[model samples]
Target: MTASYVFSVRFRLSPDAAVSVEPETFETTLYRPADPPGEDGWLFFRDNLWRGEVNDQRHARRLAEDALGVDVEAVEFRRFETDREHYDALKAAIADDLATFNADSVSEVLNKYFGSSVEVVS
Candidate 1:
């Protein structure tokens, strides 16, 4: 069975030359394969966050476990969403620190990647 949780990332961005000057809200979900213990999962964020590393997801997962003090197998990024474009970019950003998804440091990781744009809803 798949276990899930709510996670979000917040960040600022400059609008296009002709677009509005206000930064748009954006976010996404960091989905992992829940069946297997060590299988890599798909991260849904933005392009700015993607580092083109195959192990990026694994790294983030590890970080989450370290920071949260929770079992790596017990956590997953779930029910993700945003109010702007660049979905892939946001996912990439989260992937940078996938390993740190515990109760302690997951918030920090999200804040680092999304600034104030990330949030966790019950």
Candidate 2:
């Protein structure tokens, strides 16, 4: 079986090397293989996840490298998991985060972690 959800990769870029075309929100499509022992699920993967922002990680890294001259790493990703209820909760969490994200304190923390280039687009 396959499950889809929105994913985000937050990163920073050097001042001298950053892309003029900034991304608002990134999307990722997750594939849940039908198998037992699902408890062994690993959140991080090299590929097989699809995002509307760009292609594979290789492509995303290349874009960052070419445009910003820096390697873009996967800081964190938002996935709802294999359960429908959990997925819905994830969506709600995202929305709540968005609501409180623009606050001064939140921005401060986000800027510290993700830098000023932090952007959210869906």
- Highest TM-score, which number? 1
Off by over 4 Å in 1: 21-35, 38-122
Q: Write the per-residue lDDT of candidate 1 for residues 1-122, one digit (tens) a residue.
A: 23322433232345568877442533343443222222344333322232222225555546555654433432333343342332434445445556644323544555544445443333
lDDT of 2 at 89: 41
Instruction: Report model 2's TM-score to 2 decimal places.
Output: 0.22
Q: Model 1's lDDT to the true fold? A: 0.39
TM-score of each predicted structure versus truth: 0.24, 0.22
Candidate 2 local lDDT, 1-122, one digit each (tens): 23333345444444444544345334333322312222234222212232312335665455444644444565233442345444344335434554434434533433332333222323
> What residue pairs clash in candidate 2, if any at all?
24-120, 24-121, 25-121, 27-51
